[model samples]
Target chain A: MSRTNPNAIRSNRTANFLIYALCGIIAFVTVYPFLYMLSMSISSPDEVVKKTIVLLPKGLSFLSYELIVQNTQMWRAFGNSVLYTAAGTLSNIVMSLLIAYPLAKPKLVARRFFTVFLIVPMYFTGGLIPSFILMHTLGLYNNIWAVIIPSMASIWNIIIARTFIKSLPYSLQESALVDGASEFRILFQIIVPLSKPVMAVIGLYTAVGIWNDWFTALLYLPNSNLHPLQMFIARLLVFNYSSIDPGSRLKLDSAVTQTGVITQMKYSVVMVTTLPILLLYPFLQKYFVKGVMIGSLKE
Target chain B: MEQVVVQTKPKAGRIRSFLRELKRDRQLLVLMLPAVLHVLIFCYIPIYGITIAFRNYRIGDPYFALGAAARWIGVQNFLDFFKSIYFSRLVTNTLLLNVLTLVFTFWVPIAFALLLNEIASKRYKRVVQSFSYLPYFVSAVIIVSITLNILSPDGVINNAIQALGGRSTYFIGKAVYFRPIYILLNVWKTFGWNAIIYLAAIAGVQQDLYSAARVDGANRWQQMSYITLPSIMPTIILLLILNVGTLFASNTELILLIANPNNMDVSDVIGTYVYRMGVVEGRFPYATAVGFFAAVANFILLWTVNYVVRKKTDEGLW
Candidate 1:
C-alpha cells in the first residue's frame, strides 16, 4: 500500500489528522455539558444566570452543594435511592441465581417451556398503566417496596447467570452429588462462589437500573418525601422550568422567590444526584464491560 | 428459523433414573424458583394487563372485554391511533430519530470496536477506552439536566454561540433541533458503552483468519474488510434487528426529560406519551389503551424482525 503520488500522500495524512482531530472535538463537545454542569454547581447562582460565563467560574462557591446536601428532602431521597438500589440488586441477584441454577442443568421438566416462558416477558411488557395498577393491587403503592419488589427478578440477569452456570464444569456439581451433598449446599458453597464475576456484572446492571429508576418511584412511590433522587431532581427541573418561563418578569422572580432554589442551583443538585453514579463506573468498569460482553447478544 | 425440534417423547427414562436425575436436579429447581417467581410476579402478572387493551379499563371498576363498555369497538383504539392527526408525525419522527441514532450510536460503536481492536498501543487504547466508556454510567437525569444547562439561553453553550456572532438558539424550544439533539446526546452517552459488545465479538473472531490473510499479503484494510467485518456481521445484524424491535418503544425518561410543549410535536414518542397520558392526566383507561397498543406494536415489530432475520440469516432471537 505504497503511495504513488506525493499529493495523495500529503492529502491522506491531512485527512487522517483531520479525522482524529474531529473525533477529539466531538468527544469534547459530548463531555462539555457535564463539565459545564460541574462549573455551574460550583459557581455563584447570580453570576451563572447573566449568561456571561466562560469556561472557568467567575467566582467559585459551593452554595448549591451545601444547600442540596443539607436539605433534609435531598438526604431523604438519597437514602431512599440507596436503599432501593441495594435492596433491588440483592434481590435481583438472589432470584436470578435461583432460576439460573436449575435452568443450567438439563434435567428439569418443562425446561424449554419454562425457559421460553421466562424469556418472553423480557422482550414485551404489560406497559405502564397496568403495571402501575398492579403495584396498587399488590399493596406496594407509596411503599419503598414499590420500587424494589416489581423489579426483583430480571429475566436478562437470569439468562446471563444461567448461561454462565451452564458453562461451568458440570463434573464439580456431579462430584458433589456423588459425595452426597444436597443441591442447596452445592449451590451455596460451589456455584455461588464461582459466579462472582458474573454476579458482579448482574449486581452492577441491577444497581444502575435501580439507582437511575425514577419512573418506578415516580409511579409507585407517589409520596414526594419518599421520592428517589431522580424523581426529586425531575421535580426540581420542572420547578426550574416554570420559574424560567418568559412571562412577566415579576412573576418569574416571584416563582423563584417562592422556590428559593435558583435554576443554577437545580443544575448543581443534578451533580449531587449523579455524583454517586459517576463514582460507580470507574470501579465496576471491568465487571461492567465483561457483563455487557457476556449478555449483549442475549437479545 | 427452524424451531428446535423438541421431541416430546420423554425419551423413556426409567422412573428410578428420572428420580435420580430429579433428585440430582432438585437443587436446580430450588435455585430457580426465586428468579422464576420474580419474573412471574413482576413481569408475567403485569402482562395480564394486556387484556386491558381489549377492554374498557377502569382503575377501580370491574373490567369488561373488547370495547364492551362502548359496544365492542374491535381494533378501534388502534384505528383511532392510526387516524389521529399526530400518527404520521409520531412514526416519522421516531423512525428519523432511530435511524440517526443507529448511524451514530449503534454503528459507530461497532466501528470503534474495530479500530480499538487494531491499535498497537495497548496503554493508549486502555486509557481512551476507559474515558470513552465513562459517559454511559451517568444517569439520564444528570445527562438531561446537564444538557438542559447547556441548552438554556443563558447557559455556557448559548453564551458560546452568542459570542460567535450568532443569534442565541433555544435548542430545546425548537421542534426542528430536538431530534438531532436527542440523537446526539444518545450517541454521546451510548456509543462507547455499546462498543463493549462489538469489542468482545471482534476479540472472539478466529485469529487464524487474520494470519492467513496476512500471509497472502493482505494489508490492514483488506484484512479488516475481509476478516473482521464479516466475522462481526452476525453480531451487528443481530443487534440491529433487536434495536428495530424497539423502534417504537423510545426511552421514556430521555424523551420526557428533554421534551417541553414546544417540541412535543417532534419529541412525543409512544413511551413518553403513555406516561403523560396516565401519570400526568391520570386518564387510566385511555392511557391503558395506548400503552397496550404500543406494546402490541412492539411485539409485532419484534416478531416480524425475528421472522425476517431467521428466514434471511438463519440466526435470530427465538
Candidate 2:
C-alpha cells in the first residue's frame, strides 16, 4: 500500500507522533508517583520539609531506611505477610487443583452439581456480616486462620484452572487410565506435570492476591501484632499524624520532626511492600498475559 | 455455552449407577473430599448464616442452631436499614461511584488498546506496556497512599498549582472530589491490564482486512475503525456485561482506605457501610440485613446483564 498524497502522509506521521506522545505521557503518569515516593523517602527530612522534591532526591539520606530497618514490628509484619502468602498460595493451588481436575473431567459423576454449587456462590456471597459471624462461630476471628482458611479456595481461580485442565488433551489422561494408573496417579504424574503453565499462572495470582490482602487482616486480625505488611501500611497511612482533621494535618506539617517522620516513613513502607512484586513483575509479565487470556477467552 | 451431557439410564437405576461410578472413582472422590468439605463449611455455612438477618442474633447464640434463643423478627432489620438516615446516602453513593467508574472507565482500555495497536515499534510498545502495567501489581493501600500524598495540601499537585499562581487545595478531604479521584485512580490502576484482553482480540483480526482497506485508500484510522474495532466488539461486550454485573459493588478496600470521616458523605458505600456497621460497630443482624439486600441486588443485576447481553449481542458470561 502506498500513499499517493505527500500531504496525507505527513498528516499520518503527525497522528502517529501524537499517539506515541500520548502513550508516553500516560506511561509516565502511571510510574511517576512511585518515583516521587522513592525520591521523598530518600531525601533529607529538612529538604523534604523545606522544598518540593519532584523528580529527584535532594540531600539524599538513608535515615528513613535506617528507621524502618530498626523497627522490629515492621519486620515482624513483613515476615507475617511472607508466611501468609506462602501458606495461602500453596493451599489455594492445592485446593483449586483438587476441585478443578475432577470437574474438568466430563465423565465425572455430579460434575454439573458441583459446577452449579461453586458458580452460584461466585455471584452471591453470604455478605460481610454473615462471613464475620461465621468466622467468629468457627473460632477463627482475630486468629491467623481467619486470613488463610476462608480464602483457601477461590472460585474464579478454580474456574480458570479447570478451563486450563479441560483444554489439555484428553488422550493423556485416557492413556494413563488404560495403563491401570489410579486417578490420583493420573493427576499427580500426568495432569500436574502437563499443566505447569496454568499452575504457574494461578500460583502467581494467588500469591499476589494473598500478598496484597489487607482487608482480611483489618477485619479479622484486630490484634496489632498479627497485622500483615499491608494492614500495617494502611494503619500508618490513615493514622499517620494522629488525626487527619484539616487543622491537625496542617499543624502536623509544622511539627515535622514529631509527626512528619511518618510522611517519609509512609513512602518507605510503600516501597518495601511494593518493591518485591514490582521487581518480580518483568519475569512473570508473560504469564500474567497468558493467565488473563486463559481466564477470559471462550472455548 | 457448551453443555456437558452425562448419559443416564432409567431413573430407577440411577442410584445404582451412581454408586457404581462412585466406587470406581473412589480415589477421585477422596481427592474432592477436602475441597468439598471446605467449601461446605466456609462458603455454604456462611450462606446459611444469612438467616441471622431475620433474627436478633446475639453474640452468644449457638453457632449451629439457627435463631436459637434469639427471637425471630422477620423484616425488622431490613425495615430499619430502609428507614435509617444513612440508607439513601449509602445507596446513592454506592451506585453513583460504581456507575461513574463504569461510564468513565469502561471504554478507556479499549481506547488504550487501539492506541497501542498503532505503534510501529514492537520494543517501544513492550516498554510502554510494562510501565503501564506496573501500577496494577501495586496494592490498594499503596495506591491510596500515593493518591493522598499527591493530593495532600502540601503534596505535589498542590505544590505545582502554587507554582502556577493558584491556591493550594486539599483535594482528598473534599467530598466533591472523592468520586473523580476514585474513578481516576481506578482507571489508572486497571486500563493497561484490561487493555491486554482487547489487544489480544485485536491481534486476532485478519491481516487481509487491513491490507484490503489500505488498497481501498483507507488511512490507519479508517482501517482501525473498519476492522480492528469491529473484531474486538464481542470481547468488549462480554467484558462490559461482566462489569455491569457488579454495578452495585464499589472497590471496598480502596474506598475504606481513601475515605476520611469528612469525605464519608460521598465515599460511604454498601461495602464500607457493612464493614463499619458489622465489623467495627458489631451490629451483626442489621449489617447482615443490609448485606443481604446488596447481595440480592447484585445477583439480579448480574442475571439481567447476562440475559440482555446474550439476547442482544449473543455474547455474555454464562
Candidate 3:
C-alpha cells in the first residue's frame, strides 16, 4: 500500500504556489554558477572579468575553450580519464555481479564471513598512505593498473547489488535449476536481465567515482602525462590561479589568469569530462534514484 | 557502522548438513564463487597492507614485503605526530569541518526533500530535482572554481559589494570565510541529490498517519512538525548517526582545491594535511602514522556511537 494519506491531499494551491516559487529561486541559485561558467568560457576573457557582469555575456568568443583544447595536456588527461572510467566501471560491474549473484542465493557457505569482509572496508580503511604504499609494492605504481585496479570492486556496491538481487524471488533461480541450466548460465542469462535497474544505479555510481577520482591519480601517478582530465585542470585552477600573490605587473598577470577566464576553463574541463555522466543521467534517472531505507542503519 | 549490520550470510552447517545443503544446492554455491574471489583478492588483500601504518613505510620499499627484516617503529611515528606542532589543529579542523558540513549539507537536503515531497505536481518536482542533481554530477573542480568566481574580489558578489559603497574583500584569501564557503559549496553541490533519500523515507510513511493527524485537528505545519517529522525520524536518526560515525573524514578535494599556504592555519584538516605531507611531499612513515591515528580515532567514534545507539535503542550499527 502507498504511504501517502488521502485526507491530507487537500487543494492548498496557494501554499503550493509559494513553496514552488521558493524552490524555483533555490534551484536558480544552484544552477546559476555553472551557467555563468559556460557562458563566460565562450565569451572573450576581457569581457568576462568585468566587475559588474552577472547575466548576459559581454561578448562571445571561443578563445578560452580554444586554449583549453589546444593545451595538449588537457587532451592527454582526457584520454587517461576516459581509460580510467571505462576500465574501472567494467571491473566494478564484474566484481559486483560476481559477488552479488552468489550472496543472493542464501544457501552459500561462509556467506557471513564473505559479507563481513566485503562490507567492513566500506566504513574505514588504512587511509591513503598505506594503500599507496601497497599499490607501489605490488608494482602497479606509475601504471594505469594502479588507477584501474584498486577501485575495481567496492564492498558497498556489492552489498547493495546483493540486497537488490536477494529481493528477487528465489523461484526464478530454482526454476532455472530444475530446467538443468547451470548456475553461471542462469546468472548470466536470467539474473542479469532482471537486475538491470540496480546494475544501472551501480554502473552510474562506479562511473562517477572513477570520473571524479583525482586522489588516487595524485597518489600513485606522479607523471603529469598520466594525470586524468579532472586532476590536470584542477591542478591548473588551484595552482596557477594563485601562482602570483598580488601588487605588481606580475600580480596583474596572475589576476588576469586567475580571472573568471581561468576558473571558467576549469569549469569547462569539468563540463567536458562529466558530460558523459551528465548525459547518461537521463537514462538512469528512471532507475538510479535509490531509496536509503534498506542499507541505511540497523546499528 | 551502517554496513556492519547487514551481513546477509547463511549460517554454518555441520559436516552432514553441509554435504546435505551442498548436494541439494550446488548450483547456488557455484553462482556465488566469483563474488567471493573478488572480495578476498581486492578487499582483504589491501587490508593486509594496514601493517604499513605500523612500520617505517616507504613507497616501493614496502615494510611488509621485507618480512622479518622490516624495521619496526612500534608507536614511534604516532608519538612523533603527537609531539609535532600541527596535531591538534588537524583534529580540530577535521571534526569542525565534519560537524559544519553534517549540519549544512546533510540537513538542508532533508528539509529540501521534505519540501519537495509536498509538491503535488510531479513534473515540477522532477524538474527541480534534475536541476539540483545536475551539480552533484559536476566535479569538485567545477564547483570550487565556479564559487571562486562568484565570490572573488571583482566578481559578482564583490562587485555588488562595491556598488553599495563598500570596499571589495578577498573572500578566498581570508581564512575566516573558509568554513562558511566550504560548507555552503557542499550544500549547493549535494543538497538536492541528498533530499532524494528523505523523499523516499517520506514516501514510505503511511497515509494513515496523516489521516490520523488530520482527524486529531492538526494543521499543515502541525502535521509536518508531528506526523511527518516523527515518521522520518528513523531515517534522520540513522543518517545522523552515520554522519557522526565518520566524524573525522574530511573532503580532501574541497579543502585541497580551496587551500593555499596563506589559509593553511584554518583550512588544513586531517585529510589535506596528510595528503600534503605524505602523498604530495613523501614523508611516508610520519604521514602514515598520523593518518593511521586519525583512522583509529574515527573507528573509536564509530564504535562508541554504535555502542551508545545499541544500548539506548537496541539498533546497533554492527
What TM-score would each prediction reach against the true structure? Answer: 0.86, 0.93, 0.86
> For residues B1-318, what per-residue lDDT tens digits would candidate 2 score against the true structure?
123222445665667877888887778878888788888887888898888898878887865564346578889999999999999999999898999899878889899999999999999899999988888888998888888888889988899999999999989778899889999999999999888988999999999988888888888888888889999998888788888878777678888888888788899999999888888888898988988988888879988988987898778877
Q: For model 3, what TM-score is found for chain B?
A: 0.86
Query: Residue A268's C-alpha lDDT in candidate 3?
Result: 64
lDDT of 1: 0.74
**Relative to the true interface, what fraction of contacts does candidate 3 keep?**
0.58
Q: In TM-score terms, which candidate is top? A: 2
DockQ, model 1, C-alpha based: 0.49
Error of 2 at B73 (Å): 1.8
Name every residue pair that clashes in candidate 2.
none
Tens digits of per-residue lDDT, candidate 1, B1-318, equal 213333442455445455676675665666677766677777877787666655555566543233345344356566776788867777777767777777777877887777777665677567667777677887777777777767777766777877889888888789998988888888889888888888888889899998888677676667889999999898888888888877777788778788888998888877777787777887665677777776667679888988988998898877
Q: In order, what is each prediction's RMSD in angstroms? A: 5.1, 3.9, 6.1
Share of real interface contacts recovered by each model? 0.61, 0.74, 0.58
Task: Tell the DockQ for candidate 2.
Answer: 0.64
Point out the worst 10-residue segment of candidate 2 chain A by lDDT: A241-250
Candidate 2 chain B: 10-residue stretch with minimal lDDT: B1-10
User: lDDT (0-100) at residue A39 of candidate 1?
Assistant: 72
Name the better of 1 and 2 by TM-score: 2
Model 2 spans with C-alpha error above 4 angstroms: A241-263, B1-8, B66-70, B309-311
- List, residue by residue over A193-263, the lDDT tens digit for candidate 3: 99887777788888887888777776788888898977786676656632212223223444555575664
